[model samples]
Target chain A: MRRIESCFQRLADQKRKALIPFVTAGDPVKEVTVPLMHAMVDAGADIIELGVPFSDPMADGPVIQLACERALAHNTSTRDILDMVKTFRETNADTPVVLMGYLNPVEVMGYEAFAKAAAQAGVDGVLLVDLPPEEALDVKPLMDAQGLDMIFLVAPTTSDARIKLIGQAGSGYLYYVSLKGVTGSATLNVDEVASRVETIRNLAQLPIGVGFGIKDAESAQAVSRVADGVVVGSALVNQIAENKDTPNAINDAVGGILSAMRNAMDQ
Target chain B: MSERPDFSAFPDARGHFGQFGGSFVSETLMGALDELTAMYARLKDDPQFRADFDYDLAHYVGRPSPLYLAERWSKQLGGAKIWLKREDLNHTGAHKVNNTIGQALLAKHMGKPRVIAETGAGQHGVATATVAARLGLTCQVYMGAEDVERQKLNVYRMKLLGAEVIPVTSGSRTLKDAMNEAMRDWVTNVDDTFYIIGTVAGPHPYPQLVRDFQCIIGREAREQSLKQAGQLPDALVACVGGGSNAIGLFHPFLNDEGVAMYGVEAAGDGIETGRHAAPLSAGRPGVLHGNRTYLMEDDNGQIIETHSVSAGLDYPGVGPEHSWLKDIGRVNYVAADDQEALSAFRELTQVEGIMPALESAHALAYARKLAPTMSPDQNIVVNLSGRGDKDILTVAAIDGIEF
Candidate 1:
C-alpha cells in the first residue's frame, strides 16, 4: 500500500500523471519479463501492472488474450512469475508491482500460501479481474495480511453505492475500465468516463486509473487529463505480439510504446 | 460443511452452495447479476409468473413428459425394473427447453429485448432459439466450430429458428470455448441483453435459477414414480455435463434419505486414461467461467482439454451444486467410459425404441450396470435428458455408414 501510495504521491508532487503499463509476465518467454520490467521503468513507468497468464482471461480482449495464450503455450506457472518478480526486485525495490489475473490459479495455490509466496517474492499488490467484490471476502484479508493492496475495478455499471463499497475495500487505486467492452475495444467515450470519474472521486479518496480502450498516446493523454493515472494494456500487448518472434526486440518495442504514452501523459 | 447439509436452502443470498458457488465475475457484470438475482427471487414465487411458466410448459414445451417403464430392456438384464424419465419427448427434444422457456419468460418480464446463449450439441441453442422466435426477441447462440461441424442439423435448426449461430474457434473449440465466447458477449452487451445460460453453471443466480427452472423434471417424476410404481424409486440417475439435468433431477431428491442419487459423468476413455469430462470424478475444486466448481485442470491450475464422444457432456467443469452435493455425500458421481455409453445408446434404441442422446447414454450405461445388481422389486429412474436425433450423423460415421 505504501509503495503504491508513495508512487502516486510523488507523481502528484511533480504535477505529473502516473503512467501505468501492463504486460503478461511470461509473454514471449520467461526470460524477457525481468528485463522488460526494467525497460518499462527506464521508459518512465511509475508502476507496473504485471499480468499473470491464465487459461481464461474472460474480461480481456483478443490482444491480451493471445498474449496469455503465448505465455501459457510456453507453460508459465505462478511460481515462475513470482520468481520473475523476485528477480526484478534485486535491483529495484521502489516500483510497485501489482500481479493481475483470474482467481482460479490463485485458488489452486490456496489463498494464504499464495499470499505468503507473493509477499516473499517482493510482489506488492493484486488485481483479480473476475473476483467480484461480493466474493472477494474469501481472499482479500489474506492479501491484506501480506501487505498486498487489493485493487478492484470500478466500471460504468457499478452504482454509486457499489463505488462506495469498492472504494472502502480497495487500497492501491481503483481501475476505471473506460468502456463497457474489453481492453482492445475501440469505443472510448472520454466524456462519459470523465463524468464517472467525477462521481467516483466524490465517493472515494483513492486515485483512479482509467484503462481498457486507452490504446494510443493520444488516448493516454486524454485519459491522463481526467484521472490520476493512465493505463495502456492491449496496445502494448499488441506490440509485443508483433515482435514476439524476436525476443530480444520485445523490451524495446514494448518500452517504446510506454515511452510515447508517458511523453503524451506529461504533455 | 462436513455434516449433512440443510438441502432445502442452498446458494445463500450471495449465491453460495456452501463453498462451491459465488458470483465470481467481472465488475462490469456484478450489477447485472445482482439485478437478475433479485428479479428471480421475486418472480420465482409470483403466481402470475408461475402461471405463465406452467401454461407454456403444458401447451408449448410439452410438460410432464412421461415416466416411461422400459420393461423390454429391464427384462433382458432381469434384475430390477428400470424406468426412464422421458425429457427427450419435450419440445426441441431435450430437457434444455424447460429452462429456456422459463428464462425466456424471465427475460420478457425483465423487459430485455435481446437474449443470448451457448450450446454444445445445439440442443440448448435450438431450444433457446425456439423460445426467442416465439417471443419475438432477437437471439444469438455461440457454438464451438467442432460442434458446428458435428451437430450440423441442430445448427441448421437453430438458424432456421432465427438465431444467429456464431461459431467459436478458440480454445478447444468445444462447449467450454463456446461458453467463454457467450460470456464475453453477455459482458459486452449486458445493458440490454439477458443471457439464458443453458445449464446450472456460471455466476450467481444462474446456478440457482437454472436448477429451479428445471427442477420440474424431478418434481413431476417424484409424483409420477408414486403413481406409476408403488413408491419412490430405489435410486435416481442422471447424466451430468454442466449438471443441469442431474441437479434438476437430484435437487428434489436431496432431502429424501430413502432416495439415493447418482450423477453420471462422461469418462471418454477411462478415469485412468485421463481423457474425460468427468470433473466430479477426476477434477479438483477451482474457479472457471464464473463459478468455483470441480474442473478438469492440471497441477498448475490451467484447465485441461476434456474429451467425450458426446459434445454436450464434454465440458471440463461441472456445476457448483454438483460439487457441493459430491462433497456432502448426498450424491454419488461416477463415470461411464465412451464405449459403455455407446453400447447403452444402442441397447436402449434397439430394445425400447428410445434413442438417447450420447450425453444421456452415460446415465443409461450406469443404470444398466446398477440395475442387474438389484432385485426385480426395486426400481431406478434414469433421466433420458435429450433425443439422439442430433447424434445420428456422428453415430453413422462411427458405424462406417454414410448418411
Candidate 2:
C-alpha cells in the first residue's frame, strides 16, 4: 500500500485523530529541516507537509510568507528540497511527507520529471495551492502513474459539484479550509466547521483534514473532534520565525506546540 | 507559431484561451468567480445594461475621444501617416476609467456596497476612486509600498477622492504583490465586496469582462479610421503591461484580415540584460497571478523581479489573451528600452505638443521604428493611452529638476 493510505489506516485503528505539522523546508537554514521533521514525528506528528519555497505565496498569510522568504534567501532549489525528503526517508519510513506550494516551480521542472523525482525521494503527495482539479488534467495522470497521491483543498465556499469533481480526482485526504481568508488569518468557528465537515463527508468518502486559523492546542482539539486530521501550518511556522536567529530554539519551540496539541487530541 | 483558424471564438466555456488562461486561483475564490461569471453572462447582452453603460460612457467619461492626426511628427519621421487614439483625453487622464466605470456599474447591479482594486501606476486607483466616490461605495485600493513613494500625487488624488490606499509590503512589492493583497482581501470579504481588477488579467470573467468593457476603444477607433483615413490603418500599436489597452484596440479589429497588430512590452534596460519586463520577448510560459501566461521566472519556477522605467509597464506577465494572440501569430510582440521610450516621450512633447505617458511612449517608440520602414501612404495608429501630466515629476527628476 502507498505510504499515505497506510498512515491514515494506522491512525484509524488506534482510535486517535491524525496530527499533521507543516513547515517550510530550508527555513533558517537547510541543515535544520531534516532534523526538525524527525523531531516533529517524535512529538506525535502523523504527517509532515514540507513547503517548497516559492517567490510568490499569495494564499499564505504573513507567517508562512516570511518563512518562504527566509528559505529562498539561501537560494534553496526544488532539487535541494527533494534531497531533504530523501534524507528524511533514510531513518524514518512510516510517516508520510507531502510537498506543498505553488505550481510554478513544479512547472519549471516539468510535470513528469517532478512526479518521478518526488516519488523516488519518498515523497507521498502534493498539494499545489493554485492548481484546481480543472487545471490538473495533465499532471494528475503523471502523479498517479508514480503512485503519488494528489491531495486537493476544499473550501467552505466550494460547491457540491466541485466537491464531487475533486473527490474523484484526488487520492489522499482533502484539506478543508476552516475560514474564508488566507492562512493565519482570524478565528475559526467550530460549529460552522462542523456543519461544513458534515456536508463534505456526505459527498466525499476521503478523510477530511481541516486547516487555516488553527492556532493553539485548544483550537486543534476542537478541530480534532470534527475532523479526521488536524492540519496546523502558520502556528508552527510562527515559532520558527520567532526563533530564527537562535536556530537551536526552533525545534523545541515548534515541537512544544505539536506535543501540546497531540496530548489534547489524545485526551 | 501557427495561425489559429478563427479569432472570434476564444476563451471557451472553461475560460482557457487554448490552455493559456484558466481559473488557477485557490479554492476559496472559486465561488466568487462563478458568481461574477454568472452575473456577467446574464447582463452582457441585455439591452438595459448596454444602454446604461453607453449613457455613462457618453456623458460621464467624455467618450468618442478624437482620433487626431499627428501631421508634423509623421512628416518628420519620413514614413507612414500617424493617427493617435486619444485615450489620454478621457476622465482620470487615461483609458483606465473606461473599465472602472463598467465594473462599478456591475457592482451597482449586484448590490455590492464596497469595491476594491489594485494599482501599479496609480492610474487605475485614481479611476476606481473617482467612480467609487460618484457611486457612494466604500473603496479601498492596494498599491506596492515602492509605487506609493514614487506616485505620491496619484496617491493623494485617491485619498482626496475618498478611497483608502493600502500599501503592500510583501514579495517584490510591485503590481503582482499588490494583486496578491487584493486577492487576499476578496477572499475574506467575498460576500460584501466586489474586486474590480484593473487590467485584462487575473482569473476568468475578469479578462473577459474587462476586455468587453474596454473593447469600446477599438470599436470606436475602427469606425473613426474608416471615416478619417477611408480605410483601416495599415497597423496598430499599443503598450502591453497587463495588455488592457492593447487587447481593447486589437480585439475589435481582430477579424479585419488586413490590419496588423503590435503589442510592445517594456525592455527596462534591454532584453539581453535579463533586467527587463519583456516576458513575451524573453521569458517562458508559467503560471502567476491566477492565470497561465508567459512569465519572468527563474529556473526553479520562482518569479524574478522585473525592471522598467515606467511603473505602469513594470509587470512580469502579459494578459493571457495576448499570449494566445502571440502564439497564433495574430499580434507581433515587440519591445522598447527605457532610453528609446524616454526619447519618444520628449519628441512627442516637442513636435506634437502632446506629452504621452511613459507607458504609452513604449508603444510610440516601437511605432517610430516600424513607421519608417513603410511607405508614407500607409498609416499607423498609436494608442496614446494616457496623458503625461502625472509623470512630470518623474521626467523632472531625470532632468535634475526639483519641481
Candidate 3:
C-alpha cells in the first residue's frame, strides 16, 4: 500500500482521525523545515502536507501567501524541497508526507521526473490546488505509477457528478475545502460542512479530509467529527509567521497548536 | 507535427488550445467555470443576448469605430499604408469596454448582482465601473496597490462611477497579484458575483467569451479594410499584454490565408535583460491564473515580476491562444522595448495627431519597423487598443515633467 493509504489505515484501526498539518517547505528558513516536520509528527500529526512555496498561490489567503513569500525569498527550489523530504525520511519513514502547492513548480520539473523524485524522497501524495482532475489526465497516471497518490480537492460547491469523478480519479483521500473562499478567509459552520461531507461520502468511497477555515483546536475537533482527517494550513502557518523572528520558537509554537488540536480531537 | 489543426475547431470542449488554455483552477472554481462555460455556450448564439449586446455596443460603446488611414504617418514611414482600427475611440476610451459590456450583460442574464474585475492600469476597472453603474450592479475592482497609486485618476474615476476599488497588496503588488486577489474573491462569492475577466486570458469560457465579444473589432476592421482600402490589409498588428486586443483583431482574420499577423509583446528593457513581459519571445509554458500559457518564470516555475513602461502590458503571461498560435506558426510574435514604444508614442502623437496608449505603441513600434520594409501599395491595420490619455502622466514622468 502507498504510505498515505497505510497511514490512514493505521489511523482507522486506532479509531482515530488523522491530524494533517500543512507547512510551506522552507518557510522562515530552510533548516527549520525538517525538524519542524519531525516535531509535527511527534506532536501527533498523522500526515504532513509540506507546501512547495509558489510565487502565485491564488487559492490561499494572506497568511499562507506570506508563508509562500517567506519560503520563496530564500530561493527554495523544488530540488531543495525534495531534499528536505529525503532528509526527513532518514529518522522517520512511517509518517506519510504529502507535498501541497500549485502545479507550475511540478510542471517545471517534468511530471515524470517530479513523480519519481517525490516518490523516491518518501513523499506519498500531492495536492496541486490549481490542477483539477480534468487537467490532471496526463499527470495522474505518471504519479500513480510511482506509487504516489494524486490527491484532489472537493470544494463546497463541487457537484455530485464531479465528486464521483474526483473520487475515482483520486487516491489517498479527497481534501474537502469546507468553505467557498480561499484558505483562512471564512469561519466554518460545522453543520453546513457536515451536510457537504455527508453528500461527498455518499458519492465517493475514498476517505474525506476537510480543510479551509480550520483555525483552532475547536475547529479541528469539530471537523474531525465528520472527517477522516483534519487538514490545518493557515492557522499553523499563522503560528510560524508570528514566531518567525525567533526561529527556535517556531517548531514549538506550530507543534503546540497541533498537539492541542490532536488532544482535543482524541476526546 | 503531422498537420495543422483547424483554427475554428480549437479550444476543444475541454478548453485546451493545443496543450495550452485548459481550466487549471482549483476544485472550488471548476464548478463555477463549468457553469460559466455552459452559460456562454448557450448565450453566445442566443439572438436575444446577441441583440442586447449589439444594442449596447451601437448606442453605448459607439460601434463600427472608423478604420482611419494614417496617410501622413504612412508617408513618413515610406512603405506600407497604415490603417488605424479606432478602438481608442470607444466609450471609456479603450477596447476593454467591449469585453466589459458583454460580461455585464451576461451578469444581468445570470442574475448576478455583483461584478468584480482585476485591473493593471485601471482602464478595465473604469470600464467595468462604467458598465456596472449603467446596469445598477455593485462593482468591485481589485487593482494592485502600486497601480492604485500610479493610476489615481482612474481610481477616482472608478469610485465616481460607484465601484469599490480595492487595492491588492500581495505578490509583486501588481497586475498578476490583483488577478490573484480577484480569483480569491470569485471563489468566495461565486454564487452572486460575476467576474469580468479583462482580457483573453483566464480559464475556458473567459478566453472564448472575451474573444467572442471583442471579435467585433476584427469584424469591423475586416469590413472597413475592404470598404476603404478596397481589399483586406496585407498584415495586422496589435499589442499583446494578456492579448485581448490582438486576439480581438486577429480572430476574425485567422483563416485569411493572404493576411499575416503580428502580436507585439512589451519588452521593458529588452527580452535579453530578463526584466520584460514578452513571455512569448522569452518564457516557457506554465500554469498561472487558471490557464496553461507561456509565463515569465524562474527555473523553479515561480512567476517572475515583469516590467514594462505600459502598465497594461506588464503581465508575465500571454493569452493561451497566442501561445497556441505561436506554436502553430500562425501569428508572428514580436517584441518592442520601452524606448521603441515611447518613440512610437511620440511619432504617432506628432505625425498623425493621435496619442496611442503605451500598450498600443508597442504595436505601432513594430509597425514602424515593418512599414518601412514593405511597399507603399500594401496596407497594415494596427489596433489602437486604447488612447494615451491615461498614460500622459507616465509619459510626463519619463520626460522628467512634474505636474
Candidate 4:
C-alpha cells in the first residue's frame, strides 16, 4: 500500500499524470502475457491493471470484451492470472499490479481463497466491477486483512452521497468513468469528468484516474490535464485485437499509441 | 424435507424448489447473496414488509390486474376456452415490475442507497427506474447500445424516471452484453448497490427470488381461473426470454398432473436457419451469468449471438429453472418464428384491440396453433406479459409505414 501510495506521489511530484495501462492477462496466447506485462512496464506504465478474463464483461467495450473472449477461449482462469502476477512480481516488485474483472469467477474461487492467492501472488489491488461499496463490506475486510487494495469506480451518474461512501470504502486510487456508458464509447465530456474528479478530490485525498472513453492521445492528454492519472483501456485492447497473431505488430501498435499519449500528456 | 408439498413463502432456507434453486455465483458474491437471502427470509414474512408490499401492489401498481376471458379469440380458435392473465395492465405496462417492486423494497429494507440492473427491451429497466424514483433511491440501468437505439422510447422513459441509462457497446451489442455490463457494475459496487436482475435467470437466489416475486402471477391466475371455471386450466402458455413470466405462471401449476405447460421461445428466422433465440430448442446446458443453464453456445462454449424480431427474446441463455424443468419433462418448449409472431401480433391487436409486445406475441401465436387441437371444454391461460407501446417504432419500421 505504501509503495502504491509512493508511485502516485512520485507521479504528482514529477508533474506527470500516472499512466495506467490495462491488459487482459493471457490474451492472444497465455505464454505472451507475462512478457507483455514486462513490455508495458518498460514502456513507462506507472500502474498495471491485469484484467482477469471473465466469460461476461459488462463494463467493457467491444475491444476489451473481445479480448476477454479470446483469453477465455484459451482457457484462462483466476489461477492463470495469479500465475501471471507471480511471474510479474519476480522482476518488478515496486510497480503496482491491480486485478480488474467481474465477481463471478472470484466468487466461484471463494473470496478468502482469492484474497490469499492474490496476496501470495504479489497482487496489490483488485477492482470487481459489480461489487458495490455496501456489498463490499465483507470482501473489503478480507482484502484489507490480506493487505490488498480494493479499488472502486465512480460513474458520472453516481450521487454525491454515494461518491463519498465509495471514496471511504475504496483503497489505492478512484477510477472515474468519463461517460454514462460502457468502455470504448466515443462521446466523452472531459470538462464534465474533470469537474467530477475535482468533487471527488474534495471528498477524499486519494488519487483519481479517469477512464472509459479516453480512446486516443488527444483524449488521454485532455484527461491528464485535469485528473491525477489517465487510464486507457479500450484503445489498447483494440490495438491488441487488430494484431493478436502478430506479436511484434501488437507490441508496436500499443507501444506507438502509448508513446504518443505519454508524449502528449508530458507536454 | 417431507414429500408433502410445502406451500411456504421464500428465500427458501437452503434455496431450493425440490432440488432446483441454490446459490451458484462466484465465491466473491456468495457472502452478499447469502446476506440477501437471509434478509429476504426475514423480511418476506415480516408483517410490516407484507403490509407495505401489499399496499404498494394495491395502490401504486393498481394490481389484482383483471383476468379476462378472450371469448372472441377463443371462438375463432375453435377449441379450448382461452383466458388472459392481464399483467400488461400493471404499472410500466409489463410483468417486470412485480419483481422490481419486491427487489427494490428489499433494497430499501437492506439499507441499500443505490440500485443497478441490466435490460434487454427496457421493460425491466423502466419498471426498476419507476420503483427507484418512487422510493427516492439512485438507480443505474445498463442496456446494450443496440437496444438503446432500438428501444429509444424506453431509454427516454427510464431517463425520465430518474435512472441513469448506461449503454453497453460490447459483445454483440444486445441483451447478453447489457447483462455483462450490469454484472460488472454489481461486482464493482457490491457493497451498497442492489442488483435488480430483470429476469428469473442468473445464479441461485436470483432465479428463486424473482420466481417467488413473480409467482404472484401464477398464484392469482390459478385462484381466478378456479373461481371462474371451477377447475384448473388444462394448459398454461407464456413466452420465455429469461423465462421469468413463464416460470411465474408455471410454478403454481407444476404439480398438477393434468395441466400441460408450454414455453414459447423466439425463432428469429427459423430454428433450421440457425438464427434464433430458442435456448431450450437449440442450446445445450452450460454455465453462464451465475447459473448452470441451457445456453446457445458454440463448440468452444462461447455464447453465440441470438437474433429475434422481439428484442426481449434475443438472449443466448434461458433461466436455470427452465433448464431443470426441461430436463424433468414437466414443461414442453417450442419456438415461434418472427413471421408467425408478427402475424399473431397483428391478429391479437385487430381481434382483441390489445397491442401485445412482440415477445408476448410468440406465446399468443403458439396458443392460437394449439387451441384448435384441444377439446372445447378445456382451458388455456395465456400470459400477456407486456403491452406493445414500446414496439411501435420497430413494427412501423418493419412495415415501412411512417406516421
Candidate 2 C-alpha lDDT tens digits along A1-267:
998888888889998899999999999899989999999998999999999998988898888889999999998889999999999999998899999999998899999999999999999999999999988999999999999999999998999998988888898899999999998999899999999999999999899899998999999999999999999999999899998899988889999999999999999
TM-score for chain A of every candidate model?
A: 0.98, 0.99, 0.99, 0.97
Model 3 chain A weakest lDDT span, ten residues long: A1-10
Question: Could you list the CA RMSD of all candidates, in the order they appear?
Answer: 1.1, 1.0, 1.0, 8.8
lDDT of 3 by residue, B1-403 (tens): 3665688788899988989998989998888888888888899899999999999999999997999999999999899999999999999999999999999998998899999999999999999999999999999999999999999999999999999999999988999999999999999999999999999999997888899999999999999999999999999999999999999999999988789999999999988898899999999999999899999999999999999999999999988999999998989999999999999999999999999999999999999999999999999999999999999999999999999
Whole-structure CA lDDT of model 3: 0.94
Q: Point to the candidate with the largest lDDT.
A: 3
Ranking by lDDT: 3, 2, 1, 4
Residue-wise C-alpha lDDT for candidate 2, range B1-403, written one tens digit per residue: 4544576677887788987988889999988889899999999999999999999899999998899999999999999999999999998999999999999999999999999999998999999999999999999999999999999999999999999999999998899899989999998888899999999888898888999999999999999999999999999999999999999899999988889999999999999999899999998999988899999999988899999999998999888999988988889999999999999999999999999999999999999999899999898999999999989999899999995
Question: Interface Cα RMSD for all candidates?
Answer: 0.9, 0.8, 0.6, 7.7
Predicted candidate 4 versus true structure: per-residue lDDT over B138-233, tens digit per residue: 999999999998888999999999999999876688889888778767755677889999898876678887888899899899999999988999
| lDDT preference between candidates 1 and 3, better one | 3
Residue runs of model 3 more than 4 Å from their true location after superposition: B1-4
Task: Encode model 1's per-residue lDDT on B1-403: one tens digit a residue.
Answer: 3566788789888888888888889999999988998899999999999999999999997788999999989999988899999999999899999999999999999999999999998999999999999999999999999999988899889889999999998777888889888888888899999999999999998999999999999999999999999799999999999999999998887778888899999999898999888999989999998999999999788999999999999999989999998988889999999999999999999999989999999999999999999999999999999999888888889899984
Per-model TM-score versus the true fold: 0.99, 0.99, 0.99, 0.69
- In angstroms, the error of model 2 at B146 is 0.4
User: For residues A167-243, what per-residue lDDT tens digits would candidate 3 score against the true structure?
Assistant: 99999999999999998888899999999999999999899999988989999999999999999999999989998
How well does chain B match by TM-score in each candidate? 0.98, 0.99, 0.99, 0.95
- lDDT of candidate 4 at residue B123, scale 0 to 100: 95
Worst 10 residues of 2 chain B by lDDT: B1-10
User: Against the true structure, whose DockQ is highest?
Assistant: 3
